[model samples]
Target: MTIAAPTADFLVLPPRPDSTADLLAASARQRGMAVELLSGPVLPDRLRHATGAHLRGGPVFAGAVAEDLDLVLLEPDDDWLTRLPYEYTHRDITLTTLGEARWSRTPMFVKPPRDKSLTACVYADGSRLPGDADHPADTPVLVSEIVTFLVEYRLFVLDGTVHAASRYATHGRLDPAPLDACPHRAAVLDFAAGLLDTCGDSLPSAVVVDVGLASDADRGTEHWAVVEANMAWFSTSYAADPDRVLDVVLRAAGPRDRLAVRDRAFVRPHAAVG
Candidate 1:
């Protein structure tokens, strides 16, 4: 039997040129799918016929988009996800003093909670902590216990389905083939599911789950850990198979019948009215 086409209205927003969002749209079009490209900010005109939108930039307007659209794809909701209890080994410091404690037995990594653009600082020892004068901003810092990781994995969950999964090298490069054979696969799915259940409403319909594995020294076994999670729309396919990722978008829409319509106005704020 021939498969029917999907009728879902897809809004593809490429905030910048040569961005991954544009690449995804190109792939979708190749499959005979209809996708509208929003070249600049998501103004009212751009969002008028949009039922689902894939966003690449900041969440400054997510709340507004979410108010009208069925699905607004972006990164996981930072406010909601950060509250969950995870094995985040962190250090506390006052604004006046920059100090580090050898509390974590293992090597640790430091990253900003809010500013993901900042490169993560890996410290083999605690003495390398930056002083208050050198701190980027007052945003909280995370000091995570480092594990001897073997491989990293990126799993894409769309509308409650594990649509795409890919493994990556230590340096964040994508692996072409699926790592279903990897033992860490199950654990990664479990983590993703739990995350979705907790923040389902707030989370974008599509998101990427990042899982890491540590090679155990004594047993020579790999222990799975949740590395981090990012918005699927913004996260680079890295070394992911672009074709496979595009397939997920196609499947989500199914055979087109009636187009989905979102009734609301999305306004892009101006710094000052002319």
Candidate 2:
């Protein structure tokens, strides 16, 4: 049986008129997709009459928006630490269930497995978490070995290929790394390819993965590693090709039940979730 291609009815409410969200909508229209203009920053309630609405950093997968369009907001999983490669091998990073982390005694870098519901920082002591005041005492978090990264890049992946990439930071700061003339671009791409290959069919079909390169004097090489993954919807499109990125962002952020209903999961706040 021949299946017909689904019509993409994109709803765009850019943070600003000329923002990245607007760029995405423009690209979609150029591709012959139907766009529903929200006029301005409106509430999710307005989505009641719409279908396939796209919002940047839109919360949760339920409610009026969920009823009209199957919204899917992609975030990291608890086992995300195990999904990639090299844990405690060259870098000391581990995932602990909320129930088990309370037993730790060492000072560690504590962060949520997915969203930033709680601030990510080096807690002087693990037994007493800073997020205790804000997050649930039992929410799962990534306890990582803190390392200084020389460069950080965000890659938008679709299928198995990286559609758009941008270097967003350097030396733990907000300096933009130029993709056009980066000296380490080749090495970075190669390392990222290795990590993506490791993920194979494990990762979401459309998602954003952040990778970083740290200097290792002993190995005389720039060690590349997975920093984290983010929802394509909420992530910033640094210097990447906007049109290509919007393509993946649409897949990663739109109504979930539309096409790939199996991957749909609500973004909730356990201790304030994604």
Candidate 3:
């Protein structure tokens, strides 16, 4: 039996040169695939013809598209997209002085909530915090519990299958290696599965799950905890096998005649962010 190729439509920001969305769209076209490129804001006119979207615009624009589209791809699953369990994020709040984060227990990390493309400030116990919030550019600061980890892993799931999985350095540095032999492999997979279960059918077409090994000083046993979640389209493969990651992305975009089904309910009417 002959298989039908998947149709892809991308809703991107304007002047899309040297952007992730552009690169993905180009890749799809290079393969002689059916792809449509739409620019500007996400309006009904633009999304009406799209079956899938690679979203890389601002939160306002991306959220709008997500509300109307069946399958929207995103990068860095941040607060603007959705909230994670037990993760408390305070935007617009600057830590003028670090007087020890009560919730963090140990040293903590402070960084931008959105763009994490650069190094973050690490605070050890009793270290003097930055003089003021102004010290770290103007980006909002995020103070998170400092987690001592053995290994870090990234899990990408597409259409219910573990598409790409890899291990990385635990010190917020990117280094890629296949995780088939990692001891915490099963735990990371389970964590990703659980997240998908929670999302149910409302999950995005491409999602990234970050898992890390947390130190258990008392028990002397390691525990796997969720570090972060991101949208697969905007996230770089980092240390992951580029070929594998790219293949998974292309397959999720509707390759091999398989159409990725998504939830119509996931699309909601646009609402302004408070």
Candidate 4:
């Protein structure tokens, strides 16, 4: 069955919208959808009664709104990278509790599995891992061996196909560019296609996948590898076509009741578990 287009009549944005949010709001207005920018922390009743709506923002705000609006937020599994084949991941990755990860004695790239509660970066050692003052010790986290990415691109996928793409970074810095205009465009698309063809079913139909040309210090070579998967609604459009990105975002977070049975497991829970 084909993915159904969202029936949303309103597009929601957080207070003090960012450039990306402004771009999306413009795109939504162009599509004849009403846009609502929250004035404060409170969600207005008009939005609560809207027939249909889609939101774009950080996970914390999205989670709060999802509970009241009954929106479905789709995100990759906590162990998504660890479960991938070595050919795609190109490095060792482990999914474990923050407490367990703290036992490591070597440098590793450690990050929260699905949230930004903890800063994602290379920790000197397990001793460098932060204490569980803000988050619980059992929170899921992904720890991977360090690898240098020469260039990184973001693909907005819809129904297992790349709907739009943009080169989001180069050498760990923000350098947004249209993928179609970049020399590595073809290579990026090719790699994304192979990855999707191999394990697209493991992801939500509408999601964001980052791929990059990574440098192997030991082998003195460069190759494409999957960076990570993210919820389309929470991903920036960069130089990608905002219209196309919106199409994916709409499907990624819409009415929970319209969600496909297969994607139920991918939904972000309305409430956080302590």
User: TM-scores, in order shown?
Assistant: 0.57, 0.77, 0.53, 0.93
Which portions of model 3 miss their true places by more than 4 Å?
Answer: 1-30, 34-77, 80-106, 117-119, 124-141, 159-161, 170-173, 181-183, 199-203, 239-274
lDDT tens readout by residue for model 1, 57-121: 34433333433443423334334334544542112211111243333344567665333533566
Q: Least lDDT summed over 10 consecutive residues: which range in candidate 2?
A: 58-67
Model 1 segments more than 4 A misplaced: 1-8, 15-19, 30-53, 56-74, 77-107, 113-115, 124-136, 171-176, 180-205, 218-221, 239-274
lDDT of 3 at 210: 65
Q: Report the lDDT tens digits of candidate 3 across residue range 99-208.
A: 33322435666654444433466666434445454444433445665556667887776665567788876556666677786776777777667766765344545556
lDDT of 3 at 118: 30
Candidate 3 has what TM-score?
A: 0.53
Model 1 worst lDDT window (10 residues)? 265-274
| Ranked candidates (lDDT, high to low) | 4, 2, 3, 1
Residue 155 in candidate 2, Cα distance off native in Å: 0.6
Off by over 4 Å in 2: 1-8, 14-19, 25-46, 60-64, 87-89, 97-105, 131-133, 217-221, 261-274
Candidate 2 per-residue C-alpha lDDT over 1-274 given as tens digits, one digit per residue, 9 for 90 to 100: 5333234565554434446666777787787766555444343454455566654544432222333454555555666765555731257777775446666777777777666566777766666765455666667788877666788888888876788888988887876644656777787678767767877356676788888887776667777788777767767787788888887877766664554644544242223422
Backbone-clash count (model 1): 7
lDDT for each candidate structure: 0.50, 0.65, 0.51, 0.85
